[model samples]
Target: MNFKELGISEDIIQVLKNTGITKPTVIQQESIRFIKEGRDVIAEAQTGTGKTLAFLLPIFENISPNINTVQVLIVSPTRELAIQLTEVAMKLKEAKDINILAAYGGKDIGSQLKKLKGNIHLIIATPGRLLDHLRRKTIDLSKLKTLVLDEADQMLFMGFKNEVEAIIKETNKKRQTLCFSATMDSQVKKLAYRYMNDPLMVTVKKEEVTLNNIKQHVVETTDRRKQDALCKVLDEDNPFMAIIFCRTKRRADNLEVALHQRGYNCEKLHGDLIQAKRERIMKAFRNADIQYLIATDVAARGLDVSGVGHIYNYDIPENVETYIHRIGRTGRAGETGYTCLFIDPKDQRTLEEIEKTIKFKIPRRELNI
Candidate 1:
């Protein structure tokens, strides 16, 4: 079902639509309703399950834009995750008048304190840094309306149990709690049982789909001839939509120009573009207005565009994991996918390593051009 069917507000729904998030994940669909009801929730879902939006959307729905006193406190386990969550919050809250802060170690506390002086409505923080704020009395959570323990098991694993519990104790006792963990171990369950109020537990039962279903082939070509090889494959396959991955931003840019000169409906995405332009290109690509996206690995990470029928490796990835990640972009949600690899003679060793890891030999096709 759509985000609107999950009972979210229209503005956030429009934001999601602009970002090409037209459908909810299984976890989002299952958990959004309970969260909107203000029920304590213990969700079992792995990373990349769209769990962040599941909670963030409902939190936005329940929050007061005017009566802002850190209404929602989302405790993640890492600086990276807190920052990522803050970015997502910023993007989603564009239509609403909400202020957010990401508090984690490695950042200047003074800067955070400066931002905290404002009417911050939400905080996504790591345990240690959040506890620092608590001990210093620089932030007040007495009026906290909801508490989220994201990656609960990871926090315990990282030995932040005490700090998290301390942060939890400072919040309102009657506040709604949402705990999301990849696995509901004994410690996670105990933490939930002690804090949550009759929490409803739900899991996105299906495991992430594998890449084995993606049709794979290797094309023998050198760096000088890779573009011609890609064009040949593009003409041969006529993929519905494809992501042509290049090893570097320069490669992506050159490929975009070459393809554009040949009258291909394509665009390039890399870190060089301004954030606004990158977002606009992404919106266009997600809407299928662009037939091909030439992108660097950095710019295309974590993209979940649906209906991607093919993946083209215009440049051989550095390693097997990178190779897998590139091809894994397609063949999502039970849809069949196709991937073509163009490798030069020098890339044969890396290709062999990848084949040995996946235990599947990539059938090769020679290009006459």
Candidate 2:
């Protein structure tokens, strides 16, 4: 359904129209009404399903323009996700004078402290960094009206449960709580029960891994030969932008170096890189200066890069859900894309799980030497 049918504000509708987001996704259509009504919500939607906008829009509408003492608090698992959410919030360009800031670790605390002094309506932060600010008494969440745990499962996975609990206890007890995750585990459910009031639960069905607009294929090769095979694919396809997923930081770094040595414009992103370097590499990739981005799953998570024409799985993901998140980097916003997975014989079990979860067999493509 169109956003207008949801009774959104005219200003929001105009902003959405300018971005060509005339219609709401299934999750948005269902959750927007409840969120607008200021209800606690538990939404389960896959990545690349426009879930970010689903919660942000309602928060924007409900915010009071004059009183801006951090009305909305969005906690993300990674620094990259926090930054991405802030960017999305900025795009709203609400009629009210609202300031949205993102705070994360590994950056100069001085800059973040300076931004905190301003009138902030919304603060998107990572758990560790947010707690650091809380310890310094720099952030005042006394006026917090809504608290969102975006990618709740990932936060738990990252071992931020204690920090998250601490942060929640600091907020107003009567505040509204919202949680969104691609997959929910027992711990995640327990966290919700402990923190959230009687909340409405919404689960958006997981679609098949292979989008109709994307062509998914696998190339079987040994670990030693995977780079050569990837090079061959790049030579043949020459995609405008491609994201190569490695299993670990070392793998990503090695792949990046190999690609560079071969005279390809490539960058590496992993947890090892400093925040500034990661940001610079991401900027280059976004600006189309770097055609290839080799990253580990953690580093790539929560990145909202656009125009990625191809996704290469240099190492098969350990879990089926990760596979879904990996391939999702491409074929976004109704754009046609390509996904290729380098599968070794040892990864058969993981491949089977992925196929079962997605309910489709990935087509196998033989490498042409």
Candidate 3:
């Protein structure tokens, strides 16, 4: 359904239309009403499902441009996600007077302090940086009307539970809370139960997860030969664009070097890189200047990139859910996508777990190249 029917403002609607987003995704459709009504909500949906807009629209709808003292606070797990959210918020607020700020570590805190000195209606931040500001009393949440925990599960995974809780305690208790997570695990539930006030839980179950548009395949090979296998698969598949998932930062680094030496247009993303380099890499990847992006799990989460033609698991993920998250990067927006999984004999058990989790066995293919 159109966002206008879901109570989005005409100005925002026009902005979204300009950006070619006329229709609201399922998560946005189901969660907007509750948020507009100022109720605590726990929204569970997969990545690329418009969860960012779901929480963001209602915040803008309820925001007061005149009284700017950080009316809305959005906490994310990573700097990239926080920056991405701010970009989307700025787009939605085209020509509007709302002041948006993104606060995260690995940047200049002094510059952020300068921004905070001015009027800010919305602050999108990572938990650690937000906590740092809160401790120093530099940014006030006393005027906050809404608090959003974006990618709640990831934040908890990154050991931000205490920091998040501290941030919540600093805010007004009467404020509206929205927790968006990919999975409603026990940690997510515990956080909700402790802090949220009779929250409404909206979940999309695993059975309803759709990957029909994606063509999935497996290539059996050893760790030492997996890089060669990846090269063979890319040659055969000839993807428009691809992301290669590695298990560690070292793997991503080595793979990136190997691919570059082979004269492939490639880049690597992991935690070790500085923020400036990371942004440069992301920009190049988005512009299709880089055909292959090798990344670790933490570096790739919550990235907003469309038209990814292939997802390669150069190293099998540790868990079934991770496998799902990795492949979910492709096959977006009804586009046909491909996934090539490289696995060794020891990974057979992990492969079975993934099959059991997704409720189907991925077709096996031998790479004769």
Candidate 4:
């Protein structure tokens, strides 16, 4: 269906078309009408499925520019996601002059306070900082018409369930609520039951967690020689743009340094980096100035880069869900992609668990080099 049929404005549709998003995604098609109808919705969709636009489009339709006093509140788990949401909102609302603010920690609270005092139409915030604002009573949610919990599973995983509940209590009970997640775990369901009023559940399912267009392979190597194994794989793939997932920030930092020393165009992303630097790195990577991005799971939560041709698991994630999320970075937007995972002996059990979760064994390759 077209964006106009989904009740998106002609101006916003033009903006989307200019951005090359003419057709609605699966998540967008399912969730937009429900959201526009003012129904509570629990939408479960995979990463890179255009979930952001699903909720945002409905919000843009509902918000009124004349009576703006924070009509919509979007709570996200990570600052990166919050920032990305704010960017999308700004683009859609630019012609309409709707004010948008992204509130998150690791930034100046005084400045956020100043923005909060203005006639803001929408706010995209992390739970911690939004709670801070709630505590200070600097922002009022009395006029809120909608509340969005983006990445609900991730918020619960980060131990923000209580915070999220508290934030919801501050909003009007009759207000529209929407929860979006990659998985509809029990916690997400409970939150929906307790808060949402007869919510519509929408899920985009896959027979397996792995993507069909993505070629997956595993390289067996010793822990001591895993670095060499990764180098060998990079030499072979020569990907146009790649992301390497590490288990920790220290590992990401070390890999960034090592890869640069080896003369690869690479960058590192983790929690330790300041917000400005993180944005700069993301910008560079999107522009293809940085060919490889080494990141931790938390740091890569809201990454929506296109043309990510390869994903390298420098260290296998502890769980199958994380592995799916990490590899979901590639094989997006109908593009074929590749994934190479380096596994050590100690990771055999985890590999088995991953295989069990995804319901297929990844083809194994010996590190012949």
Candidate 5:
């Protein structure tokens, strides 16, 4: 359906149309109406389903520009996701003089404290960093009208449950709450039951896992030969942008070095890098200055990068869920993409598990070294 029919403001509708977003996705059409009506919502949608704008549009519409205190608080699982949410918030620049800030760990808290000073309308933050601000009294959530837990299941997996609980306790209990996740584990369900009112539940059915639009293959090689194989694949495919997921931070760093040594523009992202450095690398990658990104699962989850033509699993993730998240980087928005997995004999069991989860056998391709 058209966004105008969904009761969006004329100015916001103009902005959306300018971005070529005339029609709402299923999640947006279902959730935005209730959100505009000021009801708590729990949404289950996979990545790349246009969930970001679904919540952001309604929140921006309901925001009272007059009130200076933090009216909307969004808690994300990672610094990358927090930055992405802030970017979406900034896109709604039609809001008059609204100040938005993102707070996360591994960055200068002093600078974030300075930004929190006056007339801040929206705050997007990682759980630990938000708790730090709450403890320092640098920000107050007493005026909070809306609370959103974006990627709630991931936050729980990352062991931020206590911090999230503490932050919620500091906010006004009467505030409207919204929770969104790809998979709702029991922990996420319990949090919703405890914090949310009779929430409207909306779920998008999981799409069939298919490689029709995305060409999938495997590179069978030893650990030492995998780097060279990756370079060869890139040389052949010539992707405009790509993300290579490794299983560990050290491996991601080493892969970045190897790719750079071979004269490929690349960057590394992991939990070890400082938040500022991570931001810089992501910015470079997004701008196409860095064509290849080597990342670990923790650093890559919840990132919203479009036009990624290639996704290479430098190492098969231990769990099938992570495998799903990794390959999800490509084949987005009906675009043709490609994914290659570097698998050794030892990883056969993991591959089996992934196959079981997807309920389809991934086609195998033998690579000539």
Candidate 6:
């Protein structure tokens, strides 16, 4: 069904149409009614299932107008996700008037404090940084009508349980709560029910959706010749924007350095860098100042960017889920995308497992170089 049938306003629906999203995904279709009805919701869906829009659409639909005293608080696990959410919020806000602040680590607290003094109706933030604001009394949550925990599993996985509890305790007890997660692990469920007043659980599970839109290839190469193999593929393809998935921070760092020496424009993203630097690099990449981003899975969680044409697996993920998630970064918003996965002799077993899980034999592509 279309978003308009789901009771979304013409302005928001028009903005989504401009972005080329016409139909509502299953998660969006199921969760929007509950959110609009003012029920606490725990939604479980896979990556790339359009979970962001599900909560965002309803939040915007029910936002109390013109009060401007932090009516909504959305907690994210990572800085990248927070920024991405802000971008989405801005799109809807542009259609109307909603003052928003993205509060995360590595930003200047003084600047955030100054912004807090303004008419901010919503604050999208990371748990630690949000708690810091609460401790400093720089943010007011007394008027908060809604609380959203995006990527709930990741927040708990990243060891933010205590910090999240602290933030929840500070918010209005009567506020509506929405927790969105890829998996509803027990911990995530406990958090949802503990603070929520009789929450509703909704799940959208479609295993084949991740592989539906992307063209995938497996390249056979030796471990020592991987760098050269990657260069050949990149040179031949010349992608618009690509994401290279590495296994660790060190590998991403080393791969970026080697690619740069070979006259390729790229950057590495990991937890090791300070948050400010990560934000700057992401901004540059998003603005097309850079064409390639080499990053670990943890560093790229909840990363949603449009126009990503290629995904390269420099290192095979440990499981099928991660492999699917990596490929999902491309082929977004109904666009066909390309993926090239380099496999060494030692990686054969892992490749076989991934193929088994997806139930499709990834075709082998040979390079003349």
Residue-level lDDT tens digits of model 6 in 1-369: 788888899999899989878899888989898898899999898777888889989888888766768888999998889988988899899667877888887777577557557678888999988888799888889878999999999999999999999998899989999999988999998888899988888987755347788999999999799899999999999999999999999999899999999989899999999887888888888877889999999889877777789999988889888899899888865788899999899999999999998899999999987
Better of 3 and 6 by lDDT: 6
Q: Clashes in candidate 1: how many?
A: 0
Question: In model 2, how large is the Cα lDDT of residue 349?
Answer: 90
Can you give the TM-score per candidate against the true fold? 0.64, 0.91, 0.93, 0.93, 0.92, 0.93
Evaluate all candidate structures by whole-model CA lDDT and list the values in order.
0.84, 0.86, 0.86, 0.87, 0.84, 0.88
**Which regions in candidate 3 have their CA more than 4 angstroms from the true location?**
207-210
lDDT for position 282 in model 5: 85
Clashing pairs in 2: none
Per-residue lDDT over 218-255 for candidate 4, one digit per residue giving the tens place of the 0 to 100 score: 99998789888999889988999999999999999888
lDDT of 1: 0.84
Among residues 3 or more apart in sequence or in different chains, the pairs in candidate 1 whose N, CA or C atoms overlap within 3 Å are none
RMSD of each: 6.5, 2.3, 2.0, 2.1, 2.2, 2.0
Pairs that collide in candidate 4 are: none
In candidate 2, what residue range of length 10 has the lowest lDDT sum? 204-213
Error of 6 at 9 (Å): 2.0
Error of 4 at 266 (Å): 1.0
Across 123-157, the per-residue lDDT of candidate 2 in tens digits comes to 88999888888898888898899999999988998
User: How many steric overlaps does candidate 5 have?
Assistant: 0
- Candidate 5: residue 240 Cα off by (Å): 1.1
The candidate that wins on lDDT is 6
